[model samples]
Target: MRGTLVLISLALVVAGVVLLRSKRPAWYWMTFGALVALVRIAFTYNSVMEACGLTVPPSRLRLMLARMARREVPPDRPPRLLRTRVTRTGLVLRLGLRPGQDAFDVAASTDRLRHSFRAYGVTSRELRAGVVELRMTGYDVLKRVQMPAKTERDVMRVPVALRDDGSIQYRDYRQIPHALNLGATQSGKSVYQRNLVKELAPQRVALVGIDCKQAVELAPLARRFSALADNPDDAVLLLEALVGRMVSTFHVIRREQRISADIPDAEITADIWGLPDKLRPVPVVVVIDEVAELALWANTMEKKRRDRIITALVRLAQLGRAAGIYLEVCGQRFGSELGDGITMLRAQLTGRTSHRVNDEASAKMAFGDISPDAVLSVQAISAERPGTAIVGDYSGGWYRTRTPHTTLRQAVTTCNDTAYLTPDLPELAAFRPVLPPLTPAGPPSLIKPRPRPVTE
Candidate 1:
């Protein structure tokens, strides 16, 4: 209505200038439009707050507090809003907890708050000693792509996707060396991988891939990979080779360490990061697609091979960080039931992202122990919302997030463009697979032309 009034007012002004030759009525209409907009906001503000249960009438608060202080049975005193910080995305409400209220109470009421306000989503966090922060997302943040702003290059930080708050979420592989990205088939899991791979392609890093599924997902991006393994046998070999590299890297670190007069003994280094740039080993990012296929066993022989693979990966997870090796483990579902060492592997993966899943169990497998609330958030993601996910870290920081749509062709093109930039890793040269080019579609030529050429 306000927009319509504004348009009508503009039309009236144009008519007065062109036809009537009188500006008086045009000014009146413009004033009316402005008033309508202000009045609409004023009228809806109170009702919107009331509907969201955000407004606390002073009389009701006093009565409720009095009853609670008098030892009422329920003791249902509502939390008082202390203040709010408005931002472009939404407002952050800071609430003062009542006698028996806590941060969890506000967090538990997020569903109700979301429904009442008709908001896209709501999240809560604890602030200052006793305050609870309720961050309400006012709009559908995941409806479009939220690209990251360009900043100075930081090799350790790779911008992955956008959080609901419009801030870029980075995968700090240097700090969190390993990550577990979980989502069902076509749940935008591959898109996340594409973002990571494309971002890392030009960096001074070695890319290695283990795709046990159809091999179509990572195979196309092989131009950027230092080594590519399509089956379990090759995966085992590649993993073992990585383990050798890790041991050798540690050996170099030990040899390079020296007790300097100015440097403290505690600051002595044992990682490739401590070495000079020219002398530092090229960092390796190991991508494992469908880790479950590598873990699942079919026969005695397969079980042994799986055990070796798991042990190698466990060692990599435990000690690979200092050696400048990182893992990006992608799978549909990850759980303790997968195998013996699966739980150990998961514990090392501090960063987790769970996209749309077929069941709550899969979501829990990714974040249950880390944060139960994150599991609920992941459960709320419908099948229609493929890219929507819950991302969290070991510090209990979790939020709803989504990656932008990146086609397979784009990802492949990115890899191809940066293929010439792939760093040489002497340790992985033997394991690198040289894939054969696609054969032509036509039949082979006959050998009947040899006699005619000789006669000529």
Candidate 2:
């Protein structure tokens, strides 16, 4: 990977130089032609200097002009960010490179450039070319990079420098099992979650929501969910059942594994429904609303509940990666204040996103090390920017994305549209919430959509 990335980075340099040299019109070339006088003087002097004994040839010496030209590109077009913003955390300058320029080349010349960028306050990873192909990450060194929130996108959706194809060149959720979503209340947190859930819902993945807010938050989309947990006690029981189900499925996979040797490696994986009926291992994505609620217990019973839930979450975060059991844990706050094991739980989450938060501390907790400046942006999030958010998957650091709102009605509609696609699984069916059946045990009657409330 390292060798491949380095070669790709160098190629970008050559490509960018070609593009930049070509993009200019004749007048610029005329200006370049004027420099021929100075070029001849230096070229002649260098040729003579090497004539006696110097090993470095004038040909190699001429190539040095490209190196100098490469460095000149940045000083010519310094990014137009606020000076204070530029001097803050992990990045120094957010200059735009030519379409094919490689950031790794710039970063490699002197760790000083990267170090200086970080020293002077710019922190987000350098954005590189290839935006369409990577969808999120395109740069060799920038795969782990993140930039500041200059625009709404930077604050809401992570700007993945892809190859302009909308396709991801790197990892996606199917590959990363755990996602930690952290933001202060009203930080567009729910908006982000809705976008993710909206995408996965139609894919036939069994959606399980743990909404301890009496299911009020996620209840509207019950049509799409295979299970929803409302209160603490019920959520505890539900989670335990999920763990039990996982244990059983693992056993099934193990028994089958004896012959898995005969099967392809691709077939060895297990999910909530992929196990043979024998091993029904369909992938399970558990959406937890207010993980703090589940992790915090007021009493001994709640503590035990918290312990069990934490244990299950830890297991899922640790072992579920291969089993296709993914987690989407959302909360207004996730910190050491929640007490034991919360930090551990947060560690399990590989992907994280934060909307505008109430304070820098919350942002720091969610995005501190990877993006402290991003945390600063999170504090400014308000209701007006409902669908916008900051998403950091490390797929390309953090990006501000405006996740189009997936309203309760829209979600219900989408879920219903895709409900039939949800294959029936006996184990999953056992966990479904009993909603007292919509027909009320009477003859079938026509139903009407509830009318919306009007403003006075």
Candidate 3:
């Protein structure tokens, strides 16, 4: 007994030292968890089975796993634990599946696993053939925003937000040339766009904005924008100007594709990146806020104007990648209700994000093609969770993510700071509205009173 007392005291001292040295809260939780583990181990096979939600006369093989885990070692059968890995987030137990058991069985039991382990959440993924991985989140990771540090220097890839799994969510403009972002009002959709622009501002790319809502969203960042269109008329002109630039860029690419006497035929290419640095045209990112506005029209004349704008955007989305132009189309609702060609434009937007939408229909508009589960997930995002969203791509791998709250002032400052980086596109310059240079305020006209006194 005296020896055991000494051992306990020594263990306490070691734990104290370790906790002092570690910065993460996992250490503190694990110290208490060690005590809980002792109590958990004392539970009988029946009790463990009941706690794991297998009380209703579960299969023999399932009980075998339970007993084996508790070292009960059933007289009839025993399952094996190949390996166990404990991470800061959760534990991974690798167990051999029985004849009828599969990864789906494990996945289906995630809720029960969470309850049994007293974890916040539990998820399972197939590691390989016949092997499954259960990833449990240690805490409510989405409660606090996980801001991504600026690391990517390439204009083609920007770290826009953080995933619930602690991975950086990258908006790779190179891979996904067009994206569809949907969110209801106050659903944190605008915050995600702010984060995207904040990251893109420092890169070598021209920014064009179309905000039919009187530029309330994108106007503040005009210093960094190469073109700004707040009305449909201007939007039409701006889009046409972009199409003109696309044609010019294609011409440049085609001209550069010619093989020189010194160069091999294998080196010939058609993309903008293939061209030499001096000859290469600048990459452009066009942001359209409330794309539904551009698709909706009342009369024939308005319909014609709207059609022109929509057609331009569709063509850009379909053929802009090779020409170094990308689109980030955002809206509250985007569906057949908008108008014709909207579906085709949405089809081109491979990257989709749906925030806390107002209705299930909006969620379906964003994610129905990808996964019905994704649509359900997005629709469930509560209004309280503003920045939370369901983000997915054409790859069909979707996940819940959240962007940190970036204020309008922060976004404006980012653009102002990086305003010098806006690339000059000759075709776009004609459509870009000119603003007078900033002149510092002088003390309110000291000489203005002299003219007024003479008139009096």
Clashing pairs in 3: none
What do the candidate models score in CA lDDT, each in turn?
0.78, 0.57, 0.78
Model 3 spans > 4 angstroms off: 1-106, 126-133, 148-153, 259-266, 436-456
TM-score per model over all chains: 0.74, 0.60, 0.76
Model 3 TM-score, 2 decimals:
0.76
| lDDT per residue (tens digit) for residues 1-456 in model 1 | 999999999999777554522333223323443343334434554554445444443556667776879954442335665776654445566778655455776676788776765555778889866788877665555766556456334776777787886566788888889999999988899899988898787677889999997577888888889988889998998899999999999988888787689877765788898787666888899999989999999999999999999999999999999999999999998998888999999999988998888898998888888988898989898777668889998887798888888888888777776766666677778757566654545786675433111100
Error of 2 at 270 (Å): 7.6
**For model 3, what is the alpha-carbon lDDT of residue 183?**
94
Q: Which regions of candidate 2 are displaced past 4 Å?
A: 1-171, 259-280, 380-383, 394-396, 423-430, 436-456
Once model 2 is optimally superposed onto the true structure by TM-score, how far is the C-alpha of residue 445 displaced, in angstroms? Answer: 14
**Model 3, 149-247: lDDT tens per residue?**
444446478887767755568898888889999999999988999888887887778889999999989888888899888989889989998998899
Highest-scoring model, TM-score: 3
